[model samples]
Target: MRKLLVELGGTRAVAEMHDDIVPKTCDAVWRVLPVEGMAIHANWSSREIMLHLHGEKILRLPPEGPVRRGTTAPGDIVYFWRSPQMSRGKQLAYSSEFQRELSELAIFYGDPAGGGLAADDPARSGRDSNLQVSTLFATLIDIPREFARKCEDVRHTGLQRLLVTRLGQ
Candidate 1:
């Protein structure tokens, strides 16, 4: 997987390698300090929240509403990735490892009563551990990076339709 360092509103974060052919979601966990001064701008979607840093919505969701009533602790940092999968005709999916972690967190919080826990992953049975909060930009939205290969100038213009037509040569 190729790693790319991205700058959001002057803040630096890393982007992990992802599928270039098919649209996919990705998130990066970074270390957060006591006063990192990071700003988060989020937009609510039908099923999840889209997080933005600077002007780009990189992370998908985390503690947006009922989904994380008590799952988050004092210093745990997480980023979400939502994509359109064929399983449910367009559903959100997450990494298996991350899903497991979220499941355990929900159970640790006593499994609060609400629609929030229903959408979360199944809890993992094992030792509960504390994780460090790493501040970084996660790609909650999927991208067709391979499309860039078909073009002479491989710069994104914020328009998927245009990219799709000009890409994949």
Candidate 2:
């Protein structure tokens, strides 16, 4: 029943951890309280904002952690275990094969179902298999009507500041 307060731009949102369903994942996130990062628009997922924890190390997902599949609804918080990107030696070029290696905290602000991706639709595979393997940790709760609107504004305006912290902390 842990609660997280997420501040995006000037709007405030709340998320309730799914400890019952994803206990391990919730513990991992809880240990890293007050995760401050920049909210960037996701490239692979639609209507989702990815929290980029710059220079911060994150706990690795458990080997047998619970994995949630399919499209996420508005207010769903997903964790992406991004692999480290590799650079081509001596070529001074970055390879797309290993691009976007930082772990991401994704916050969905729109309904995936409305976007033609059903919750149980098997055809909704992500851009890569890695995305499909991301974990669902929590869901936003008691969100204000303006929360999604502000997220949309931030998505279009540029990267915005986001703070994820526990209720008492």
Candidate 3:
């Protein structure tokens, strides 16, 4: 099981990749290690923050394994890609490259995840039918309270520098 270190400001957490079930996805994510960017909170997905992949760091990987379509738990780290045609207006938070097409690492940090709102949101529902691809490649071993709080802060405080790196590198 390969591990990853995810850092946000002063908070940090470790995640273990589900390589046994999603080898290809795991390898792809591992190759993009040391990715740092301004992360934004999700308006549609609750308790989630996203690190948008820009420039050469963007990955357009295919769906692999028996990925869980809907329903996500806290500590779920997923690789999500949205096709160029799926733009929901100007992606002001993302770069030019991601305006039309997007590749992002989404970190689900709390309960009521995969829902659309802070409460139960059946509108988006985290369904596979809507997303081009959402592959759950890793999950945090333990979600620290501080880390979760920091992620929640992004919703109010604006973009924050988030970094993801391969463990023991």
Q: Show how many residue pairs clash in every candidate, following the order shown.
A: 3, 0, 0
Task: Pick the winner on TM-score between candidates 2 and 3.
Answer: 3
Off by over 4 Å in 3: 95-97, 117-131
- For model 1, the superposed segments whose C-alpha errors exceed 4 Å read 1-50, 53-71, 86-115, 118-169
Worst 10 residues of 2 by lDDT: 86-95
User: What's the C-alpha lDDT at position 52 in model 2?
Assistant: 54
Model 1 agreement with the true structure over 54-123: per-residue lDDT tens digits: 2122233332212332333311223433222212322133222222222111100111212343223243
> Residues 1-169, candidate 2, lDDT per residue (tens digit)?
8989999888898899988887988888898878886677654466787775544446567423544556467888877664553212442222232235556588888855123342334543544444333677888986577888777776578768888899855
Evaluate residue 110 in candidate 2 and report its C-alpha lDDT on the 0 to 100 scale. 81
TM-score of model 1 relative to the true fold? 0.20
Worst 10 residues of 3 by lDDT: 117-126
Best by lDDT: 3
Which model, 1 or 2, shows the larger TM-score? 2
Total clashes in model 3, counting residue pairs 3 or more apart in sequence or in different chains: 0
Order candidates by lDDT, high to low.
Answer: 3, 2, 1
Residue lDDT tens for model 3, 59-141: 99998878464678899999988777655776677655555778899999998688664224344334534546788999999
Error of 2 at 85 (Å): 5.8
lDDT of each: 0.23, 0.67, 0.85
Scored by lDDT, model 1 comes in at: 0.23
Q: What would the C-alpha RMSD of candidate 3 be, to one decimal place?
A: 3.2
